[model samples]
Target: MDRRESGKTPRQLVPVVLTGAMGKYGGELWDAAERDGRIKPGRGPNFTKRVLPDLAPLLRKDALDQGIPRSAVDRSDRPTRGVLIPPEEGGPFPERLGPCGWSSEDPGEFQWDIVTRGRAHWLLARDAVATGWLAAAMHGLPHWADSEPVVFFSTHTRRSARSRFGAKFRTPPADLVTVRPDPLFPELRSVDAATAAVQCLSSVMRGKKTW
Candidate 1:
């Protein structure tokens, strides 16, 4: 039963990582960075004149004062790996909900409770799953891999028994890929997603990295 001695070795890392959809996704700025080679091959640090100073001291001492051009920084040499969900696309289905729905005469007039609760449950789970992924990264053994994969669960239309719980509430989904049904996005409510995403990356860096 000693498989380790039988000419097999344990894998050093897993390829997939989960992050919050709301906070990590790329936006106009990231897009510009990608276009300008600031993030060179998606491996180097972001280089804005403003941000460059914050990162300059991070360079190893031997490399410091070496007269090396910023462009000469080897991008493919970064130890950690990452992906983003972008501000526009992240959240409880950002594309689906609009301001018009919530501003009507009756907030509950359209049986939107079911949708809202579904969105909350999915987002909460997403936060939990992202935290676990980050915890794994904290071990310092993971080598980030690059890939963007999206999976979705079956679409279901169902009514919640506790729609009138006073505040938002709903049944949680059994799967991580399920979509959130709600459209309302509150800045304060989104903090959990942001926090989990930060944990995912910060844990891996032992708190050295801040998102």
Candidate 2:
């Protein structure tokens, strides 16, 4: 069994958590864990980027110009936010186009941009939640295949995108546990579960150094 999973093993991994531009605690945790040998960091920021059909030519030309292929234009220029269309009662896609187009409404069809190694930013955090890696990589939450227990930290004062995303998507059971408000000083918390998270992080570091 992995060190974190086995009670015999000490907590080694100490992954940090972050939300895009609002907060960056995850990076702080990573730096601290790296400096101290007892703690190890795991997981990096994961994010999603919207993909949409480009309409620059559509704006420039009132009518189709030279019959340019819809797929030939650059999609990267599309807006990042705003609804392109309204949801239909029983249609695959809405009938109208908004700023971002159809990709803005459907979560499943929304293209996800993920990064394996990078700064733990808000975009990454959102993507991690969207992709099912936020808790495990950031807060020592359990993996779907693991039997080890998990603990969750949340902003109790208010609902957050992460919490909402998990609820909307029905976050995996193993990834959910006791969730609380964002700690004023998360590093100062003392709990058995917290200790386990630290030990698990340590184990994660030990394995990383060898590789």
Candidate 3:
């Protein structure tokens, strides 16, 4: 019989809840769990397969209304070569451009640029719901109520902050940890965010050091 069932104090087990499980960052967290032999197949219907398709149209429309051009929408059936605007001479242009084509040139413009990308929108919408589901599941798990679970978010933004999923982390019980690699280490930064998060979590779990 389980110790808890026999009136013994339940062993404390820290459960790691990864928000962007299928995304680049979440994938790293999953891998980290695998290395620690803590990986388990997620329960319930696949969120991406069963839920995302139905929501994609609504999300796509929202993106369009948010200034994202239809052309930027990612389509599974075709390739999307995104637009790239060259930097103006002597203008304040960022040295590097992100996947969504935004740079450090203007914060306001960069914010819009991010929402306009279909890929970005898709990822955001999916993550929003996935985290919600994770939160609910964690609440239902045994002994979870007694300890706070670590939630790793792949990314966030001002807009996402207002989203239901984002709001969850912003508020209570969930210990939200944004997994980012140290920028000073170029090699580490080059790796996926998920991998970096895993490394950091591993370090913390081992009580070796704080991230």
Candidate 4:
């Protein structure tokens, strides 16, 4: 009865990751290989700086261009992981300038939300899955705002990540995932509303912010 001891393992869930469109737009940022992970037979960090290389620099200048003192600008290095959503702190999501630790209590300089930023992130990360309220909104539900933390459901090892403000990742059974049905990106998938509701409830039970 013990599957682990019986030499049996659970089946793997493989989500389809599309990058053709993004590759065309992004211009060969990174590659996804089987064993090596990143494209181009690379395994090291400096694998491919050319992929979305300009994003960080753009965000870095977001504050400095506004006359925020050079001392105030956060010159932190971009995160090494594949962040689905840019962290509000030290993230490269453009329009979100920071003192490297911007928050509700001490938001410095400026932070703007662009509705299409998710699309850009998806372009950069071909495996992202919008989840929770963000998924509901993507599935045509109304009343969702850009101010909320963007949620993405991922079971992929390298694709999943948790962050302070930007894209938040949730891993669940994902029994019934579905596409968000966008004209431009119909391939974008998500854990259905029921799964997302359960996830949100679980977050609340675990003492995490419900929203």
Query: lDDT for every model?
Result: 0.25, 0.25, 0.26, 0.38
Model 4 lDDT tens row, 91-179: 33211111111111111111222123444455545577876655544433322223456666566654333553455555646365665
* Candidate 1 overall lDDT versus native: 0.25
In model 2, the runs with Cα more than 4 Å from the true position are 1-135, 139-156, 160-211
The list of candidate 1 runs beyond 4 A from truth reads 1-19, 41-54, 58-211
lDDT of 3 by residue, 1-211 (tens): 0111122222121222333332322233334433432222446422211110001123445555666556654421110122222111232321121121211122121222211222233333334321222222212221111112222233443233343212222221244433212121111111233433454456558875432
Candidate number achieving the greatest TM-score relative to the actual structure: 4
Q: For each candidate, what TM-score against the reference?
A: 0.15, 0.18, 0.18, 0.39
Write the number of the candidate with greater lDDT, choosing between 1 and 3. Answer: 3
Q: Give the lDDT of residue 154 in candidate 1.
A: 24
**Local accuracy of candidate 1 as per-residue lDDT tens digits, 1-211:** 0001122221122112333443333455445534543222424322211110001112333233465444433321221112111112223321111211111111122222222322323342333221222212211111220110111122243332343322222233454332221122211122233443554466457953332
Give the per-residue lDDT digits (tens) of candidate 2, residues 1-211. 1111112212122212222452322244333333432122345431121112112212212222545334432221211221111111232321221121211122211121111111112222332221222233223332321221122232333233342222222233344434311121123221234543554566567773121
- The superposed Cα distance between candidate 1 and the true structure at residue 87, in angstroms, equals 26
What is the number of backbone collisions in each predicted candidate, taken in the order shown? 5, 20, 1, 3
- Give me the candidate number with maximum lDDT: 4
Clashing pairs in 1: 24-85, 25-84, 25-85, 25-86, 26-86
Model 4 residue runs over 4 Å out of place are 1-115, 159-163, 174-176, 200-211
Candidate 3 positional error at 162, Å: 25
> Comparing 3 and 4 by TM-score, which wins?
4
